[model samples]
Target: MSTHLCSPQHVLVLNCGSSSLKFAILDATTSDEVISGLAERLGSDTPSIKYKYNGEKQLIELAKGQAHDAAIAELVKLVNELGLADNLIAVGHRVVHGGEHFTESVLIDDNVLTAIEKTAALAPLHNPANLLGIRTAQQAFSTLPQIAVFDTAFHQTMPNIAYLYALPYSLYKEHGVRRYGFHGTSHYYVAGEAAKLLGKEREQTNVISAHLGNGCSVCAIKDGKSVDTSMGLTPLEGLVMGTRSGSIDPGLFTFLTQQLNYSVQEIDDLLNKQSGLLGISELSNDCRTIEEAAVEGHPQANLALDIFCYRLAKQIAAFLVPVQRLDALIFTGGIGENSDIIRDKVITQLGFLGLECDEAANLAARFGKEGLISKGQAHAKAFVIPTNEEWVIANDAARIAKEG
Candidate 1:
């Protein structure tokens, strides 16, 4: 909340993409962001960094376009300019695929870097970018410990029965091909918040949580750990997403190849990039765009919205097998926390156990506000709890820094 000055032990969080990097400095004691920024269009003709510090926003153009190196160099200048670098304790990097090796956050070292590189095969687009950010942060903050927080680590608790696909056991053993769920950090954060709202420890809570954003997934959290999730192997296997096709018939791939002469690479792009809300609505991938179009008598947009709600409700109902006694159904992430319309439609389609969606409560809970979106005295309850994954990363980084 301060403008310029801050105390010690702040955690610097870095979430790096192929061409963009997001950085945040959080007070270790309060989890409040001291400074936050993003760098975009790295390695492009017009790369730029934007940051907020001391209640004012600033922008700088990185003409060199030196990718992560340039962005992090600018970040170092920003931190040093604010005189907050000495107070920083650790840097947290969001690595999307940790495979089975990283069951928890670890202080980055030679072995950790090697392991992250090995897992790059699993997340081709994310892990390499994450590694670049880690190495750059190491250069920028050489003395500070860099911590790797995995997106798949929390779901490592899932029993083999839930994670193992029906495919050959040899494939899993040899190639490490099995269902390793994503969004564990987000799921873990919101589950704890849900437990607090329920007046129970996270270990005693049971709920199904849906994180609806560009990348979507539903997690069945039983006893504070993920038992099952909608996503498998990759994020593309979950409920319909902003641009992904979600779960599709495996035969469709063969069908496309045979009937349309589609290459494997083409199929991958079709399913992972061109499908979902964008493909169905033939307009935009954003929920707001589709919702607005549906209101204006756009049939395709309405159909896309309906399919999203239906499939999401189906997954929620299916997750009941893992979450035997549901405490509350949670909605989080961008769309889940903001779109009252999507929440209402999805809850209505959840036929079993009759979840009463209070229209007023649903509308009131939007825009980052957390509250019960169910009627009073309803048998089943649903809550809109905004997720704070960066908080989790910062806490994990600080704890690891202290431990190391």
Candidate 2:
């Protein structure tokens, strides 16, 4: 193959979870994905990687108990065997908690890695895996630049009033305790996309973006900057999630311990792993399952669906206070993009905002397609746009690599 000045360069974006590694190689010039895959069920009896290339999907099995480092090594070997390693420019990692240290994506170095590690306490399940990916990638591709894009970076723009908890100021001053929202890359990307759909410049766009996955967050964006967000300190503080009980009486923890003889760890496990939709419906954590049961006249399922929509609408209303004006409301992520029933229920409660959902349009927007789901002449509209965090990560890496 002949090399040319305009040859497409690729940036590999990695999102390392506790038990899985999701990756995508995207053409930096055109923002198109060349390949995407997931290596999951690691450190278990069965570990495997599913990769897609040239429109063909294949799976690679690994020995049991393989870890992230070994998973990434296999990926690197695959890239090299395909003769694509030479065109790889950089690797971008998704770091879940940057705290206050990173307001933007930065090329990683020793000090940056240390800062990320320091914030590990704020993100026990995420930061360590993130750092692992960073370290492993460094060893696999020592010559290329590695960038850290933070999940909390966009919400670092929030003012003190919005992020501060009502707890004593000394806790925040001494312990670094405050709201540090997650899913910022998704929020920021979809906000920009929302602006384009509204035919407005990013600087003039104001909106509320909801990312409703297993872990969910809602962001209030003013002129493209996050003014406020739902998740606080940790990801467990926001909307009712697949398993996470969103916001609850802070004293409930003590109540469980005192009255129920539950240990602190047990209470934590209850709220974070056993509550929310699953607890409410006594069925499944999945929204689809709950909606289906509700349609079949299950009382608990109906109650859970009502609570989810009501709580989500309340949070959206609270976020509107930060921006003082709204242009649109965007729904993204699994539940947001695919569930028209939940969207309609949430919007029906927000009638005071002069927003109306166009049911037919919402029905048309599924399987990762964008659609406008608002009635004509409404002051504020609702939209469903697919979130592209990997694209955001790759773009940031490319820009930082070019600057260097």
Candidate 3:
């Protein structure tokens, strides 16, 4: 039997993004959420931090020009003021890119921090902010050990064939231009949970987990390990996301730069921030907004929604070929959890593969709950499992800390 370390009393989790900080406090023993909230619009005119603890909401108004470090310090202050700091046994930070080095969560040390910094160029928007959260938390909680739980770590199990790019070997050796799938912790958690729901050992299960949020990826889990995933070297090479283009022809970028007089930076901004549902809808990136527009007879909004579901279904089917015998299909993340219509459409396209959606069940599974949403006699299990990436980070951190 695999032994798990005795859980900690409490663990604080931090998810720092380019311009925002989200923090969570968890009761490690029960894996229950104590509180969670976000610091949004960082470095902007109305930079603000909102936190909730013990079922009460609190807001912190920041002066203009608040940096990431300052935002983290403020989060620390709020947690302490709420009297939860006394129970904090260790800190867990979400690091986006671990390159090829970190395969699992590791206790943070000077060397580990340095190694993470060296990989910053791989995830410029995420790694820097993540590093800042780690350092700032270290300074604030000097007596406690901090752990780095990576988003890319869970995907390290991907075989060589699945991770390697067809590009020249020399380029792979010179630069780390290979697939490092993101949303791994979520995929890892949900896949195991799906196996349990199916009354099967995780190691004997085959599942496809779709994590569809602003940033999205579909992971193919075989025997509890990632066999294939939609995301490539970066989060950019996957299904259509809120503002991201997902996957675009490489030749288009070259054509834009050479013929249309666009710079590399301009191309990156256009694809990463000005594309996807927003570009196609010509409205808002929010799915709710797009759905509203579609209801009002907006052809572009309907097209964007259709294309998003079709692409997602197509990719999930592609991953299914490798697993051969898929036991379950799981949908998690912001869009997947709440958007019943989108879930129905995606699953409808997969009916040929013995996937049948129970529309009523899909509509009822919402707000961090898990439920079966496939017809009773369907050959494959379809489920909606709300993901808990922060809890995964905290569990790993607490386990590693206990071991040491």
TM-score of structure candidate 3: 0.96
Cα RMSDs, all models? 1.4, 1.7, 3.5
User: lDDT of all the models against the reference?
Assistant: 0.91, 0.93, 0.88
Between candidates 2 and 3, name the one with more favorable TM-score. Answer: 2
Q: After superposition, how far is residue 356 of candidate 1 from its true place, in Å?
A: 1.1
Model 2 Cα displacement at 11 (Å)?
0.3
Q: Tell me the RMSD of model 2 versus the true structure.
A: 1.7
lDDT of 2 by residue, 328-384 (tens): 999999999999999999999999888888889989999899999989677789999
Give the distance in Å from residue 83's predicted Cα in candidate 1 to where it truly belongs. 1.3
Clashes of each: 0, 0, 0
Ranking by lDDT: 2, 1, 3
User: RMSD in Å for candidate 1, one decimal?
Assistant: 1.4
lDDT of 2: 0.93
Which portions of model 3 show Cα errors greater than 4 Å?
1-8
